[model samples]
Target: VGHTIESTVLALESIAATDNIAKNLGIEAGETIYYVKRIRYIDGKILCLEESYYRQSIVPYLNREIVEQSIFEYLETALQLNIGFSDMYMHVGKLSAESARHLGLTEGDPGLTIETVFHLTNGRPFDYSVITYHYEHSQFVVQANGLYL
Candidate 1:
């Protein structure tokens, strides 16, 4: 038996980059970039809100149909980009009013926020994203391999 997982793309647009986003993506402020917002559900229950920004110079094109499928697959198979690694941060936070509404919770409800910056094999940052997970439904597992003293 397994739980069903689903994702809905809420917004997908091209917009001028902000300073912070520009810095994260190694692009200039006001450069065109693709922004995508989506929500993930498990077992028919909303679980997380995800927002991502991609460099237009690298990604070039995107559409609702493509985004609803898999951006990673397009980047790898079509663009031939090598996804190398990411830097991530996680923290406890209160959901914003918009996030709460999408998650079926009240504003200020507890949530887990994860921020990540993804890089290419050449160490160029191409995507930055933030994901907010519903506190009641979120679970995380980490596996470590190392020598313990």
Candidate 2:
């Protein structure tokens, strides 16, 4: 759980930095990109979600600073939780249409898939990914892509 939290933080930071660089290079509109991080707990397990958006342009003064600040606030809140999990159950990268179908995600739904890469100081780095499809705007169907370490 600790490793997951740490990796999540690093991943978000990297995304924020990348967004800044992209903005400076004019690859993405500075006001159109934003980062979102969400955390949930179920059955004594913690699940973290992070994504970088480039199409939503509904905010004023949208920049890397605002994005990083929001992430920092989220981490501050998550660090207060006590999670009890020794081993993870799912992790992987990329999602194809077939994979989504097998995972029960409908074809027409708006969904977000995350590919998480983790580097540890004493162990091999790994990629963890998840796909979430939402229906009815109330619930999401989740699928894990690879083995959890």
Q: Candidate 1 lDDT, tens digit per residue, 45-107?
A: 887899999998889999998887678998999999999999998988888899899888999
How many clashes in each structure?
0, 3
- Residue-level lDDT tens digits of model 2 in 26-85: 344343334444332233233333443322222212344444344334323543322221
Q: All candidates' TM-scores?
A: 0.90, 0.24
| Cα error of candidate 2 at position 21, Å | 23
Q: Give the TM-score of candidate 1.
A: 0.90
Give the least accurate 10-residue stretch of model 1, judged by summed lDDT. 140-149
Q: Which portions of model 1 show Cα errors greater than 4 Å?
A: 1-3, 145-149
lDDT, model 2: 0.35
Q: What is the clash tally of candidate 2?
A: 3
